[model samples]
Target chain A: MAQLTYREAIARGIAQEMRRDESVVFLGEDIAAAGGVFKGTVGLLEEFGPVRVRDTPISEQAILGAAMGAAMTGLRPIAEIMFADFFAVCWDIVVNEIAKSRYMTNGQMTFPLVIRSGNGGGLRFGAQHSQSVENWAMMVPGLKVVVPSTPLDVIGLMAASIRDNDPVIFLEEKALYATKGEVPDGDVVDTLGSAKVLRQGSNATLIALGNMVPRAQLAAEELASAGIDCTVVDVRSLVPLDTQTILREVSATGRMFTVEENPRLCGWGGELASIVADEIFYDLDGPIVRITTPHIPLPAADALEDLAIPSVTRIVETVQKSMNS
Target chain B: MSLDVVAPLLLDDKLDLYRSQFALRQFEKRAYDLFLENYVKGTSHLSIGQEAIAAGVARAMRPDDWTFATYRGHAHTLARGVPMAPVFAELMGRANGLMAGKGGSMHLTSVEHGVMGSYAIIGAHLPIACGAAWSAQYRGTDQVAVCFFGDGSTNIGAFHEALNFAAIWKLPVIFFCENNLWMEYTRTTEVTAVANPAADRASAYGLESIIVDGNDADEVYAVTAACVARARAGEGPSMIEAKTYRHGGHSRADPGKYRPDEEVAEWLAKDPIPRYHQRLLAEGASEAQLVEIERAVNEAVDVATEEAKAGAVPGEDLLMKDVWANGGAEWRN
Candidate 1:
């Protein structure tokens, strides 16, 4: 095992896949030469050359449509949409074309394509650049939504998403790009729709997705100091949700707390809360607690942005309130 | 304007084009009747008067070349050699349909025949066609990709992006626009600024573009052949706008009252099938041979329709099938 940053791990995962399969190619804005604005595609252009590492124009519609076409015609294309917010410009291609092509073709076509985008708000990039739209993607039936928190998880999930026969929306948290963790040296492939228990506790269950996983972990540590043990679960693949694992964890703890960066209304946290209420309501000793961003656009100013987003302190307070109730 | 130099066509080639066009017409006519009889559910955009474009383009393309078409793609698929039985079965939503009753009329695809897919979205397939062409070039193959869209598609962003990309990369692709002069109920003039969409934009993309009489199968075939040759020769992409008209409504329901009667009458006078038939007779082809071809086409359509009616409707289990090629792990029961 070797230590790698989240950005490096993602690039390595793509490089490994491209080496293994010649059909794998990268298409995005400034992904080539500039090595991606986030440096997620560093060293890829030099190794793969221009054909495999393509720099497309600022046309998300064309980028996604071309990727769909290439995938249908025997090429594994990995398209980067730069930021999750930019998907608004090409929403039709994603919802209507890429998401529906497999079902519409009735198994006649296979879209082995991956769309990687920077998601979430922590750097104060303003409303347009900072938004976690995983919930919107989860609403679509034919797509697999993946969000990895750690470097190791990103590596494994990136490899698995590339190998998947269907379209995958891979969301990389912009803030977590520089975060460092130990990634296994060889090929590390994780199954989609599987959840990982990052910390073990029995007092309460803290389920988090993407960047929220680390915050939940910190909250769990704080709760442990306060004599309230908490278990932290990383909801890696949101679409094919690891519901069984979540149910088991929630049943064991008898209390559930969900965390996400998206707005509180109709967010992924709501889905988790509803599932717990429907499946394991009797086991819960207290009401389900959700720590999420309020229903307001993220501001450019640091103070207002921090206030709107869910913080570790907020998670701890929510957990304490649930414990008291 | 008609071609100054008419390309020479052998008797066999002329007969083949005529037979294909006849088969397409018979198939579409029967499909319309089936829709009326309630055997084929859902509305279909029929390409009755645009048979020449489909037949000519499909004929010009090699078997290995890929084709991406729009919603009105029955004729395109037929011309590409997809069996009539599967086509009808698909329209009838039977198990023996082209996509096993999954992709009905608008989404017919035959990977074996190199018909990649027929997109329901007007301009969505343009970028995809460029990708397929790029894939062929990346894989070091001379195979070209042909994309068929309507005049309205030119106004979309994807159309410009695809043309620009194909031109810059020098990808082997042919953008064939069937300018039927109507985007559903609206005339092309109302929406688009240019008179000739394809030719007007070709210079902007630094690619060659041509305009052809879409009703003339021979002319369309000749124009497509030249574009195909240019792509195969590594001369990059070319656009061919075939100016034709739809004889019926955009879909099954509309009466197409929006179009002027005089305009419709003028186009009706240039009906491709009869004009080609007359041309064949003028070229000393016997009338008996033409009759024999028509008889064969009619018989084929009848057999296909019967077989499709007899085919089984897809069961409930198929509802969850084909969501993923590897069987979606998330949706597995």
Candidate 2:
């Protein structure tokens, strides 16, 4: 067994696929000789060489359009947008081109590509650089959205996305890069639409994704000491949502809550809440609560930003008070 | 290739060029007539007078090569050797359409014919063409990607990005611009910074500046052949500007009222089909030979129209069929 940081897992995950398949290529800004700005792809250039691991220009449209063309023509390409917020610069390619090509062409063209970007608030990167844009991708019909909460989940989900035939948006939690977790001895490949129940309880179910998963787990642990037993479920993928696991967990406890980092309006939580209410409305104790950031631009100031995002104390208190009512 | 001269072209080659332009001309006229009859539900863009570029370019390329077209793509689709029925059915929203009516007139795709797609958005296909060439380069293949766009595409950001990317990476791509004078209602020169959109920008990307008379089939063929050969030989990319004009308005809805009648008569006099027909007669090509080819092309259009008219509008089954590779649009268990 070995301990691997989330950043290390990203390179390993990409390297794992590049080793297995010659057609799997990687391209992005500052990713080749520079070892990536985030340093997640440090050794890929050395291993795969310059041909397979390419460094692109500041042209986001070129990077994505190239990936799309390559994917359509018998190659699996992974393009990086550098930051999730930059998706706005190339949303047409991602949504209009990549997402709808398969459907529009009547399955005549298939896109086996992965678009990876650093997501979420922390480290005070400001509003322009930091955004959890998984919801932006999830709202599209053809894209598969995946956000990894753990280091091992990174490798597993990355491998799954590269193998899947559709375009997958892999969002890496920016703050979780330095955090380390155990890496088992052999290869690890996970499913895209599966949710994991980290901690089980009978009182209620707390479903969270990406950066909010760890915070929700910590909140669940702290609340356990206060006699409020809550189940923490990590939603790994959003598009092919694991409604079975989510609804089952929420149904067993007859309560549900979503801890989201995206803005309140049109976040992944809002969609899940609607689904939960539609499917299992009678199997609830109280109204489903969504612990999320307010609908505003995230602050760059460290203290204010920390207060804006839902913290463990806030999650625990919100769940405790809601359960009591 | 001399200007408006076919001395270097063989008699059979001249006949083939005539057939290509004639087929496209007859097909477009029929499409416009169908729109008048209320058969075509949405809009269609007809490249009536721009047949020389399509004819010469498609004739010059290898059948295995890929083509990326724009929304004004009915000419490009037929140029790739796709039967007229599927394309017409696609425009008419029929079940037997090119994409099973999933993609209407603007997004016709025929992978079997190497017509990758007909992108509706302007300038989007330039980089995608670069990507296709990138794959061909990666796979160690000699296939070159030929991207066709209007003059308006030159001003888009993707156009600049793709040109720079193609130049830096030396990808095998040929960017062909059909300067049909009018980019939708306005003249291209009124809004453009440079007079020659595609050719003038070639210096910025370290490529040669080339422009040709698009009305001359022999001229476009010679230039396109050289560019394709250069791409296949791994000589990076070539940007070509073909100066042509659209005989009709931009799309089916437009009557082209903004154009002065004198300007319209000047272009209509230089219609590529009749000009090529006259050229074929002078090049030792018999009038009977061309008359038979035109007859065959007209018959082909007539047969395609009958078949497309016989098709049904796609049902709900096709509506949800192609959302994923698994042939289902289901997002959940």
lDDT, candidate 2, A1-325, per-residue tens: 8999999999999999999999999999999999989999999999999999999999999999999999999999999889999999888888889899999989999999999999999879989987889889988999899999999999999999999998999999998999999989677899999999999999989999988999999999999999999999999999788989999999999888899998888988888889889989999888899999988899999998998888999999999999998
Pick by lDDT: which candidate is best? Answer: 2
Model 2: interface root-mean-square deviation in Å: 0.8
Tens-place lDDT per residue, model 2, B1-333, is 222322356779878888888898899999989988988878889989999998888887888899999998888889889999998998899989999888988998898888999898889889899999999999999999999999999999999999999999999999999998788888888999999988998999999999999999888888888888888889889899999889888988899999999988998898888888888788678888988998999999999999999999899888788677677787775
Candidate 1 lDDT at A149 equals 96
* Pairs of colliding residues, candidate 2: none
Name the candidate that leads on TM-score: 2
Alpha-carbon error at B97 in model 2, in Å? Answer: 0.6
Can you tell me which runs of candidate 2 are displaced by over 4 Å?
B1-8
Mark the regions of model 1 whose C-alpha exceeds 4 Å error after superposition. Answer: B1-8
Worst 10 residues of 2 chain A by lDDT: A179-188
Model 1 chain A poorest 10 in a row by lDDT: A100-109
Q: Note the B-chain TM-score for every model.
A: 0.96, 0.96
